[model samples]
Target: MATYDWLFSTLGLEQWCGASGGSAPTSLSDLAAQSRGETGEQAVDIWELPFPSMDALNDACPAFPQSRELTLGLEEGFLDIKDTLSVVLDPITQPLSWALDAALYGILNTPWWIVIPLLLAITWAVSRSWGLLAFVAACILGLAFIDHYDYAMQTLAIIFVCAFICVLFGVPIGIGMSRSDTMQNATIPILDMLQTLPPFVYLIPLIFLFSVTEPKLYGIAIILYAIVPVIRLTNLGIRMVDKNVIEAADAFGMTDRQKLFGVQIPLALPNIMAGVNQTIMMSLAMVVIASLVSAPGLGVLVLRGIRNLELGVGLVAGLGIVLLAVILDRVTKASLARINATHKA
Candidate 1:
């Protein structure tokens, strides 16, 4: 007898329980026991309750649904809408694929001599610190020495393209949020969801939406994962600007545009830069995960190491990633410091 048998019979559910046929329906445990040449009486134990499951319930009534059916239905529903989604999303996202491919090609094909000096010059220009310039140069040269330069560049190229797009779109959305309480209230929930979701979860829907061979597949994932910080910080930085300063701008007969660009944005630059720093780091982290969908870079080496059990390969690639992270972090922080110093002056 099933665990719910007594209740079913008491409730006059004998037909549903298959007991109207003059015998109670045996549970799965009973059938298993019989198959094993043991009677239900021998296998039954009070200590081990035989819980009625979906399978047992379905056995009593073939019309009832099972758990697997629920999952199958969900999958079928998604598949039904996938093509329609792709039609709308593909063209809109195609530019991202082009940009990613172009960046990767340009970075990989560029000679190290040119890339290294140009990076050092940019670092010096941004920070105006010889120390930072030297450190960045050293890190780049070290990766080159280890023959990881190309892979490192591949990773940087992806970050460069995706992070640029994140900032481009995130800043405006943030500014909108800062200017309107209603916008902020509506957007906060979305930003919270994006920030808290697991990194791998970003790729699952994308995988179904586009083929893995497409560059935008991974580009979208990296952007979605890394964009939250920039938007949040941009909004915070703008809103945190001193009201007195804004009032002074108003006294000068400045319009909202002038107040924003000349006063709020300049004052908010430091926080915005900090957000950029975090966005870059998050971009790098997601780039590695995006490699699961064919994002080229040091991540491919790392994944290969895991798949093939090659510890040295994984360790070296990981070290290269750490070096890259340090390089980016220092450059952005130094730039932020410069902005703050200029603001104070």
Candidate 2:
């Protein structure tokens, strides 16, 4: 006799139990074992903890649902809305795919010699530091020597696109937030959630929203994961701009737009730069994770290494990522330093 049979009989639930369509179990102690495909005849030890499975409850009464049913219901619910979400989201996000594809194509097809020299020149122009220029050159050259140059470039191309979009849209949002307390209140919670969420979680909704073959599948994930820092810092920077400076601009008959452009943004440049720096780093980090959804670059190599148990492959790809990160960090920081110096002077 099942342990719950007496209770069911006492409660006039025999009819309900008959309708449940579950097999009889000797006792609640057997629920976990039954769920695991084990025999349910074993006795429960007094010292052991008991976990009554939802299936066990269902066996006792038809009204009770099994755990699997709940999970299945959730899956069915998401599936019901999945098509609607894709229809609404696909057109709006298609351009992101185009930009990412273009970047990957341009970077991959360009010869190393042309790409390397152009990068060095851009670095030199931005930082005005020959030492930094050389370091950046060395890092890229090192990746090329290892035959990891293409992989590195793929990673960089994604970062270049995602980070640019992040700043383009994120800065305006930050500016809006900085100008209004209500907006700030509404935005802070979202930023907090995005910043704190696990990197992999960013991919889950995107995976369902877009096909895995699409570039925007991972592109969306990388952007969502990396964009938070720039927005938060941009807001902080603008709000931190000195009130006296703002008043000074006002006294000179500067309009709100002029004050923002001439006074506020200029003073806030350093913080904004810092945010860009962080956003770039975060982009790099997510690119690796995004590889799971078909993101190209060193991350693909890294993921391959992990999947195939190739220690050397993983290590080399990881080193390539490190080199890329250093090159990016140094370049951005040097640029930031130049901005700070110009402001101080």
Candidate 3:
């Protein structure tokens, strides 16, 4: 009775025993042993765990903590390029690093009141059209008006660096893709992986490979997240070149390489530019999440707002990002148009 009470109460098995006022064997092992000796209708199963034999007992738990160092050994030695390239990039990338830091410093040092009017003037000058200029002005002032300028600039800095690098690398790769089928085939899958992976997931591997303070930390993540569209558009634009144009170049006795350089790439410039515009936009989008990893600028404000539940702070910083994205998109699209018009003329 004592065993029955403990077993029933402890395992909550009394519910299964129900009607007969809860009289049953106290243990699964006792039932199992009795089941073997019982014959015909007297048999029963007290356990849900299917066991063909005693093998099931030890097989239930998982084995782990298997240290590879003790069990087998390191799989081959480390490759030299991985470590060598890190050292080389650390020194050679100084100029780019300083430019970004300078941009951030420039914004941080300026007073909010001074920065607002300066921003409005710059927007008006670059945009030229009154409405475009006002829209740009309002966006900048709205961020500052709501007290978000500083954080916004940090986001701007990251995007500025990353997008510039994307164009720097993406345009050339796109041009190359336009010229070669093998390269496009090899490159597209990698781009697809980059595009498809969740943004948060990119930081995990990056954390191991580089410190949070490193410039390339955010630079590489932004590049990886943003490179796809530009490269694809570059490839598409080049491939979309009219066959007649190619034939005309050939008829002019232009070599294959010459034809590609002179004609196909120029024709595809719009698509390549469109890709760049998208890359810049994506780099801006990443700033907020990148803030968690010590990325500076507007996202830091956004992070602060969220961390403290400061609604005003988060909303304003977010608005600043919108302003920056619009300005960048407009500037890039305008440049693409000017380039295309020149090419056509």
User: Highest lDDT: which candidate?
Assistant: 1
Instruction: Please rank every candidate by TM-score, starting with the best.
Output: 1, 2, 3
Name the candidate that leads on TM-score.
Answer: 1
Whole-model alpha-carbon lDDT for candidate 2: 0.87
Report the C-alpha lDDT of model 2 over 215-265, residue by residue, as the tens digit: 999988888888988999999999999889888899999999999899999
Cα shift from native, residue 268, model 3 (Å): 1.1
Measured by TM-score, how close is model 3 to the native structure?
0.70
- Model 1 lDDT per residue over 1-345, tens place: 344445555767777645442233345665676678753444446787645777655544444566688888888988999999999999999999999999999988888889888888889888889888888988999889989999999999999999999999999998999999999999999999998999898898899999999999999999998999999999999999998988989999999999889988889888888989999999999988999999999999999999999999999999999999999999999999988887873
Better of 1 and 2 by lDDT: 1
Q: Where is model 1 more than 4 Å wrong at Cα?
A: 1-30, 33-64
| Candidate 1: C-alpha lDDT | 0.87
RMSD, every candidate, angstroms: 3.5, 4.2, 10.7
Question: How high is the CA lDDT of each candidate model?
Answer: 0.87, 0.87, 0.71
List the lowest-lDDT window of 10 residues for candidate 2. 19-28
How badly does each model clash, as a count of residue pairs? 0, 0, 5
Candidate 3: regions farther than 4 A off: 1-96, 106-128, 255-257, 337-345
